[model samples]
Target: MRIALNARILQAPRTGIGHYVAELSQALSCDAQLELDFFHGWGWSRQLPAAALPGYNKWTTLAKQVPGAYSLRRQLDQYRFTRGVSRHAADLYHEPSLWPLEFAGPMVMTLHDLTHVHYPQTQPRDRLAEIDRRVGPAVERARFILADSQFVANEIRQHYGVAAERIKVAPLGYAERFRPREAHALRACLAQFGLQPGGYLLCVGTLEPRKNLAQALRAHALLPEALRRRFPLLIAGMPGWRDANLAPELQKALASGAVRLLGYQPDEALAELLAGARMLLFPSLYEGFGLPVLEAMASGVPVLLTARTSLQEVAGPAGVYLEPGDDQGWCAAIQRLLGDQPEWQARRTVGLQRAQEFSWKRCASITASVYRQALE
Candidate 1:
């Protein structure tokens, strides 16, 4: 079958969704039966992990710089998409991000999360509304819907009233890059950031409202004076959404010398930090799939996370669950994980084994199956 994938998320320095697209696309590279064409709505200024596909095509003006995001602009940019997409004609177009927009051909969509629905304040207004207002009915445009988890599948049904049969859970997986790193090598990489191995509790994600960064920072500041000295709190990933509100709060925690804001560390350096950290503190308010939590688990690090949200479904019993917005509760959980050795080791081993069951190849195979299902 000819399959056209929406490659917009793969166009930049990959974050959560970007990494998902990159690894899954690369996993499809070895398959010969599938005619895979990536729809690059704009010029290819950025690099994707996959080698150049013989069928890949791009718009002369590039979708990134295109002015018509909603109408003529987006359509004109992806005009090639309407012209069948590949040599055999696309059996289905797969938009890997939330909504599959304006595809000329029959399509399937992967709704990664409904954070936009449940936590509207965390996203820009227009983007948030478009998902529910448009994509809900737009499900009829595609042959089927692929959700990252059963949590998200339920969410799609709850928010859109779409039938459960329309959604299938194809839970995501961690990249091969996220794994254990050598201690000395990890230490060297940390030194460049003026950080020391095993000296910090790590949290990875954009500094956005849903990530619950403000509460996490306050919790780090409020931890027992003695415990604070033992492990610094490190926040990684890029600054995104309502980040201005988080700046002053982060500054106060940083001044205490109990927190380090390492914005957007490279994936390799990030893997090392994960490898050697005391533990991962993931207090996200919501998630479709908590990739970092799994990445930490894959690297054999004990993880502290919120018991609510879709994260619980991903981390299982391996995660140390705490109340979502409780600062004192976060502090208490961090302490118990760091100060108690027996509890920490037991959770860490379980997390590592849980991580082993997830992989990109599996994600890709499932994705391919979704495309075929869309066609049938």
Candidate 2:
């Protein structure tokens, strides 16, 4: 079967969805039964673009500030997509993001989360408006829908009334790179950032309101002065929307040297970062599937996460859970985990076993089946 996929997300620095697309595309390509063509916004190609073009981030940021820029860009993208579709015929088109382009073929879409719907204030006005306008119609247009977890699958049924049969829960997987590393092997990579193995706590995600990082910073600050000084909280991600709102608290944390912001580490560096951490702290308010939790688990690190949304599903029984709003609870949990070596070791062992259950190869196998089911 010939498959046309929207690969436009790869044009930017990879976050959750971009990694999904990149990893899934590579896995799907290995399937002998499939012929894949990627629609890279303005053109079609068989090979995926390796990385973001130089200056694409600056250009996108600038474009978002200009009036009517998004609409104009969308129109041009549609024109190019329509023209590309006419030239390269395919049996199905799969959209790995919320908004799928208009397609008259069998369509498959991956709804990563309902964040825009559930937390409207988390999004910028224009982006939220665009999602509000497009997502419902896109859901209606898709023949089959992919959700990252059962939590999000239920959200789809509740919010959009999409039937359970039509929606498939295809959990994501960690890349092979996210495995445990020895202290000796990780020391050099960690040294580059003045980090040491098992010497720092990590929180990995874009800096956004939905990530609830301010809460994490607060919890870290509540640690005893010596504890905070010994194990600094390391945040690894790019600056995202509404990050300025976090300034007051973030500034205080940084001033005390209890928090370090390492913006958007590359995959190689990030994997080492994850593997060397004392533990991974992820207190996201919501998630479709908390990929960072899975990645941390895969790296044989204990995870402390919010006790809500798809985080529980991703972490299984391996995570140390706390409520998002409970600052005192978060502080206590961190203290207990730091002091209890046996508990940490047990969690790490179970996390490694749990990580073994997920892989990109399995995800691709299931996705291929979904494609065939859509055709039927």
All candidates: TM-score: 0.88, 0.97
Worst 10 residues of 2 by lDDT: 122-131
lDDT (Cα atoms) of all candidates against the true structure? 0.75, 0.90
Q: What is the TM-score (0 to 1) of candidate 1?
A: 0.88
lDDT by residue (tens digit), candidate 1, 136-237? 667667667888788888887887788787787877788776777677778678888777777788889998888887877888888888778778888898
List where candidate 2 sits over 4 angstroms from the true fold.
none
* Model 2, span 213-301: residue lDDT tens: 99889999999999999999999999988899899999999998889999999888999999999999998988999999999999999
* Per-residue error (Å), model 1, residue 288: 0.8
lDDT of 2 at 298: 98
The 10 consecutive residues of candidate 1 with the worst lDDT sum are 55-64
